[model samples]
Target chain A: MSTTATLPGGPGRQSGQDILNLVLTVGLLPVLMAIVIIGTSLMSPYFLGWMNVVNILRMASFLAIIACGQAMVIIAGGFDLSVGAVVALASVVTAKAMAAAASAIGGPDILAIVIGIAAGLGSGLAVGLFNGLCVARLKVSGFVVTLGTMSATAGIGLLLTNGIPVYGMPKGFVQAIGRSQILGFPLAIYIALAVVLAMAFVQRRTLFGRYVYAIGGNQEAAVVSGVSIRRHLVGTYVLSGGLAATVGILLTALVGSGQASLGGDAMMLQSIAAAVIGGVSLRGGIGRVEVVAVAALFLTILGNALNLLHIDSRLQPIFLGLIMVLAVALDEFSRRRMSRV
Target chain B: MSDADLAAPAKPAAIDARGSRILQGTGWARQLALPIALVLLLAGFGLADDRVLTTYNLLNIAQQTSYLALFAMAQMVVILTRGFDLSLGPTVSMVSVAAALAMAGIGGADANGIVAVLAAIAAGFALAAACGLFNGVVVSILGVSPLVATLGSMNIAIGVATTISDGRPVQGVPAAFADLFYRGSILGLPIAIVIAILVGGVLAFVLSRTVFGRSLYIIGTNPQAAAVAGIPVKRLLVYAYVLCSALAALGALMMTARTGSGEPNLGGTLSLQSIAAAVVGGTSLAGGRGGVGSAALGALFITILSNGMNLTRIDGYVQMIVLGAIVILGVVLDRLRLDGR
Candidate 1:
């Protein structure tokens, strides 16, 4: 872990230690994924099979999309506890809309699919808008705003679902979102890749992204530089909400039902973990979406490896928790060292 | 480092808040809001159902408030220090399950059951200590932020608990144990209520009177200042996290008694709910500005809201929305008060 990337001399005249820290922070996950892959393949014959690889990618896609959204909020120096709830609520709304549309039209129809997707995305956007307004306009803490939304979203989800799963979506929606394959890959995986790529571009190349980073890095500096902190923050939050809703809608299509519990606590926590592990700084103004998506992939691979190794599903969380702590601590330590330099 | 450095910024802010308190009216209104809202809530509930104000129901509210009061304080301890334990809910679940599992494993109802109960509580505390120590070390010694550290540990705790309980409720608790501890009264007050009061008194006294508590606030407010003042910032932070985990375990113990079983799912909502209570009671998430009294008030507020809503026959789903709304309201008012100052 302490070894450098062996290309220490950069244009900025960085040292070997700086290169080492960079490798430790950014490259550790890929290394871990490789190690897990090798270890699991040795332990189980089927671990590295094509079907298993595809399965892992499919599972990873959901979390990747979520991490993409969460990274934006975090980069803006905000938190969103409501992502899981948003997922649940959006899922319920999407499923319900699809079911209603199908029934009203007296058959399976493309309109139902359109209505469901639109409803899911809309709800997510609405939550994002609300969170953004509260944080930026109302001047409430982002933590508080998101916490309230998380609870309310869950409640609304439950109210809609009545503690029962809402089923009967248009078949086309599920087939398209869940099972559609291009070059032997699920459509959801492609969607996740697109989201990850788009988010990465936004974070790296866009003016809005630069403004978000500036605001999060130092609000006073950003303000002095003529950035509108309020507007940027609102935009980041709204984007976060909208992205989470996308996942909710996708999950609904995949499951062919809407469940208030669809976005479990694990999903929320894991998304945050994936973001942090992917090198996104919790304090803001750091991290890349492409990296975060890979981190999510790393997590999925790790989970799959654990299953192949026959680790009890229940014990996996303990490992995950420990790994998350280690990852964040590693990130913190490297950041400290880099700052001192 | 001079006295003026501390007193300079502190005095004017104090004066400003005081000035606003006397003039702006919103300053005072925010302070009065909790009690006022509480009174109105009770009155409305009482009006809707004459039985809501009866002695039995009032006492019932007190009894119901006990565990939540503990939970709020548990969260408040860390919140006072500019950190929070997202792992608390899982801590509750783990402790409850651990205690119940220990007692159930022992199988004997004899020997005054004190030994068995003591052993069970010890098991719970041991688990609590692990969680606290892990969080403290990861956050304080390793320099990770509380959010990442606790979020990771939360997953681990959840996994450990669910695994231990086989993802099912553990119900072999001695009938006598639950009956005596959960239902038995001391001096006409429910034992749980008595314990809550005693703990609240102790925590309050500690926060107001002890060097440890004072240092915690200082560290939370500004670590550099705390270090300059010769406080053991790292060690105390660890202690604060430990204290948080232990108190959360105590709440879990109470919950276990109330439920008469060990439940892995018991604390799924506790983390957010306790946070909601603490903030509502006047605790700031920014830290260094709340106490046990505030925690008590917050817990009381939550309990009243829930109980009153029940009395009014509002659906549970709507109660969740109201709870979310109240949490947001609390933070908004806090923000306004700060701005006014």
Candidate 2:
């Protein structure tokens, strides 16, 4: 079994202070968001408009939902590069299911949605389990294992569709899930919020959540304490995969079609960025679902503000990339400073 | 003499230690399970399609493998040092464009074109080195995890490449330059393939023979131990990253010359595929082990897979799925070997 590699100080003395620091560090995301809001509102009237704000929220919702699972994986000291690929594959599966349901069940709206969600979650669960088996049983690095899964899942998507886009998804389905607003708020936004809250509850109140933190903090310690490393690791990835699938389903609903190539290739990076920006340690064992949700929303707002300001669309990637780098750089600096003390 | 004193003979101690060393050395072969699987796949494909082994198809595979082989070597070095350079793909694309533009700037003479190409190489080295330096400084000195640091760099590199080209392809390199890459051959083999072999060979030698190379393995295996032992851990890591990016630039040059144009998307799959090749070839993501030569072979295997799949008229999209599956299988097998250890 691996032992905790101590660095001068033990965990007991610093754990309380570390928790306080994490709280303050994670709070920075929401603070930044407030600044962005005030600045954007001051700069452009359109920025403050309810419509634009709602649009940003809706966009952030998709990413936030996915990041919820991502947070869990990071907490477990693992990564899921296959999330984007899973989304792509899940979207295709959902579309195919919807079409079949429509033909057999007289417009398979509800049934199709249910089946699509289940299929997406199931695929994700399988992939997660596979990744877990590799990492826990086989001892492969999470980074490489998930990366392999990423490529294979993407291949599955292509093979299933022959690279063709699946179109003519039911419009009603799209409206209800993707575009419909209840009480002046987008359904997707509400869904994202609900997911975030649920994740927060799980992370704070559940034994499994505590196990995730323990594993990330020190795998050896967790194992010695009798935590089922394999089961928990698999569960974390399964949650991540399932969330990714949910995002895919939402994306399909929004677009009313499924394209094998539609999901973001940059998603893995973006999810990591959001988590880091929200103060999730890449070293693992620390982070909050709420922080990631805020970070995702902040990024969406930044993108929206840039778009409204007539910035070229192509530059968006560059700016976001810069932000990601800076975020990590800042995190590193802070971590070192904290550790030094 | 006491029974304990007689039982523990000093003479046999050295023999036992040497035996363990030999056992550890041979341990590398167990890592070859993935590469062996890849070979089986190639054999399977060769039997399924006669065209897979045709000289023309084989040559095609070699040419394609050359590009990724360079990439795999680059990735291997970085991974060996326990870091990654996600900016590699974009760095390659950018270098490719710079080389083509440099050629155009130098007019049409072969000598001048060659000079331009070297200058482009220098530029690529310089640029990639800077990115690597940034990552190294942030990760090693600032204490950021490799995943976050490199993920950010990947985005920035891609953005920089696209921005430099204004999202347009750069075409019309000097005819001689293109001819050198596209037409030059030795004994019916492409010059690019020859260069790739040389690069792979030299890198393998460096990894095995050089102090800097040995240091990389030590640092990767245990950074704290390496640092405590007085190794310049940060500097070595930075150099590894620089070497990785510089090689990626070389790949870009070859790709640009082959296409006679610079496309922003040239290295889109390079990062993932190169990493896959390295993993499949027995490079441990956990660090401290692997060879560039194995990575070269892994790249060749991937190239063969692509070529054979093409010959069979498997849709390009489906091929992606297969590639992904291969990557996952590679990692899984690698994990199994590690677990055995």
Instruction: Report the number of the highest-TM-score candidate.
Output: 1
Q: Indicate the residue-level lDDT of B251 in model 1.
A: 86
Off by over 4 Å in 1: A1-26, A105-108, B1-27
Clashing pairs in 1: none
TM-scores for all candidates: the values are: 0.91, 0.89
Where model 2 places Cα greater than 4 Å from the true spot, the runs are A1-28, A107-109, A168-171, B1-39, B108-115, B180-182, B186-188
lDDT of 1 by residue, B1-341 (tens): 11111112232475346434434443445566778888998998888999899999999999989889999999999998889888999999999999999988887856556766887889999999989999999889999989989988888899999999999999878766676668888989988999999998898767755788767767767889989989988999989989999999988888898999999999998988889889988787887767787778888989988998887889999888888888998899777765765
Report the C-alpha displacement of residue B125, candidate 1, in angstroms: 2.0
Q: Which TM-score value belongs to model 1?
A: 0.91
lDDT of each: 0.85, 0.77
Clashes of 2: 4
What's the lDDT for residue B40 in model 1? 92
Provide DockQ values for all models, in the order shown.
Answer: 0.70, 0.59
| Model 1: per-residue Cα lDDT over A1-341, one tens digit each | 32334545675556656655556655678767777888888889998899998999998999999888899899889888889999999999999998999989865488788888899899999999999999998888898888898888889999988879998887888888877899999888999999988887887899998998998898889999999999899998888888889889888877878989988667888889899998889889888999899899999999989888889999998888888888777777776766775
